[model samples]
Target: MLPPFTEETARLKVQLAEDAWNSKDPARVALAYAEDSEWRNRDVFLDGRDEIVGFLTGKWERELGYRLLKELWAYTGDRIAVRFEYEYHDTEGQWFRAYGNENWEFDERGLMRRRYAGINELPITADERRVAV
Candidate 1:
């Protein structure tokens, strides 16, 4: 039987996600998902860890200088919700701050089996620049 989802587990999941983003390694981040995981990131839909890794690699490549910060919004049972804000400069030197929310469903083993994310980008002005923590 699967263990109950507690506050500790929810907090740990958020921390793990943050750590994975900080690592900036697509392969390593993909390991947090199940083998057949599915994701809807922005407008892209992907299945399986390999596809997930590939998607992330491509994203990081195009969205150069990427940095992210994720915060736990809520969690219940095996599902977790997060709100994230990230800043990245495109290959052409356009800077943006992307704000998004993600809903995640995890399997019994704590591997994310499904993810749905929605994001919107806003151009940042030079005077509005703020460092990510």
Candidate 2:
């Protein structure tokens, strides 16, 4: 699962990420990243796996019923770009659909070394929710 990925491998990588995030397991998801991974998630910047785990923990706590879908937009060398959508509801029961894109750089070991993401959210009624989870 090193870099220079083929189409099949790239798709696999995307699917794996989607699954990990959907699991809502911070530690599990963090395992895919390097020890000193760097990330720009929305407006916040994070460094290292510890920060990733903490961020995800808080995120999942705030975003109930989180469900994510990610597609591989492109891949070259050790870089991958993804387009993603996710749905979640806040504690107040207001639902939201988030659309985003992420650029990821991987180390030789296939661990993500850097990630940059931009995201926007739209309010939605419960009836508008598409993902079952």
Per-residue C-alpha lDDT of model 2 across residues 58-130, encoded as one tens digit per residue: 9999999999999999999899999999999999999999999999999999999999999999999999998
Model 2: how large is the Cα RMSD against the reference? Answer: 0.6
Question: Against the true structure, candidate 1 has what lDDT?
Answer: 0.86
Clashing pairs in 1: none
Which pairs of residues collide in candidate 2?
A: none
Clash count in backbone of candidate 1: 0
The numbered model that scores best in TM-score is 2
Looking at model 1, residue 95 earns an lDDT score of 84
Candidate 2's error at 70, in angstroms? 0.5
- Candidate 1 lDDT, 4-53, residue by residue in tens: 56778787888889889877899999999999999999889999999999
TM match of model 2 to true structure: 0.98
Best by lDDT: 2
